[model samples]
Target: MSSKVIHAIYTDDDLLMQAVKQTREANYHIEEVYTPFPVHGLDKAMGLAPTRLAITSFLYGLVGLSVAISMMNFIMIQDWPQDIGGKPSFSFLENLPAFVPIMFELTVFFAAHLMVITFYMRSKLWPFKQAENPDVRTTDDHFLMEVSVGKHNVKDMSKFLSDTGALEVNLINK
Candidate 1:
């Protein structure tokens, strides 16, 4: 199914951005970009939308809170009753101080665990899944540009890479 991937490596972020602009100007489709560090405005430059993970985390946190409150209510009121704190143990609203800790724990638990699960699912990643990085060096000190050449000559792409200050270029076959 034509699993052709090409990468161009640049030394500096400015040069990499120039290359990206040139690629856009020439109407080349970019597959992905890898940088050694987070670059501000890069997502906007690439026209990528913001992730909605925060919203998912909030919803999960709410679910956890509800579960914790329901469980506490059932245990303290219906299942067993004990009047140790000299407060109304049957009515949770009368003694919310004790239930606060459990509620907080549940909220944190749900936010962390569920958010991680959602991230993994959204990224299509699972345990023991091999990484899909184009170049191992890109994770360290290099900036990588992955582009797909369609209806364009490879020679032209090579020329473009050279003009964009690419120190190295390579093709990956999957």
Candidate 2:
């Protein structure tokens, strides 16, 4: 059986938000929403779970810190044992202050770069990836809301979207 979906387009973000709320209230299953830019509170409005990127970033930072510490201990205290500014060359504890800047920079670098990579991977965004958006206008100024039509009437769904301030509504068979 072919799947049917309704695409509701809105010109303004506010209208899109209201339409989403109205659609949910009317018991329509919203498949997705596409916007030109990030919309504040859109996830909450859509009842999506909070992201865990911050926790992953912290873990990446910890890994970076551990690598920095191990690398510094091996290079400075164990392998080469450089004597700079009359500081102790054989003890990592005594020379930790000198490694603080490197540790901090590496931690920040890992957190930032790894977080970006994780986001890209999680979002399925990669070089030369084809766009999945159904409407190209959604990448510009339009906001598109997709509603799944399992057993709902198509005309009723279109009217509901129009009533909720949709600029245009189209039905698609997928």
Which window of 10 residues has the lowest lDDT sum in candidate 1?
A: 39-48
Computed on alpha carbons, the lDDT of every model, listed in order, comes to: 0.86, 0.92
Residue-pair clashes per candidate, as listed?
0, 0
Query: Evaluated with TM-score, which candidate comes out highest?
Result: 2
lDDT tens string, model 1, 42-153? Answer: 7777767898999999999999999999999999977887888576587888768888999999999999999999999999999999998777887888999988876677
Q: State candidate 1's TM-score.
A: 0.88
The prediction achieving the highest lDDT against the true structure is 2
TM-score of each: 0.88, 0.95
Total residue pair clashes for candidate 1? 0
Looking at model 2, which ten-residue stretch has the lowest summed lDDT? 81-90
* Residue-level error in angstroms, candidate 1, position 149: 0.7
List CA RMSD, all candidates: 1.9, 1.1
Provide the lDDT at 31 for model 1: 85
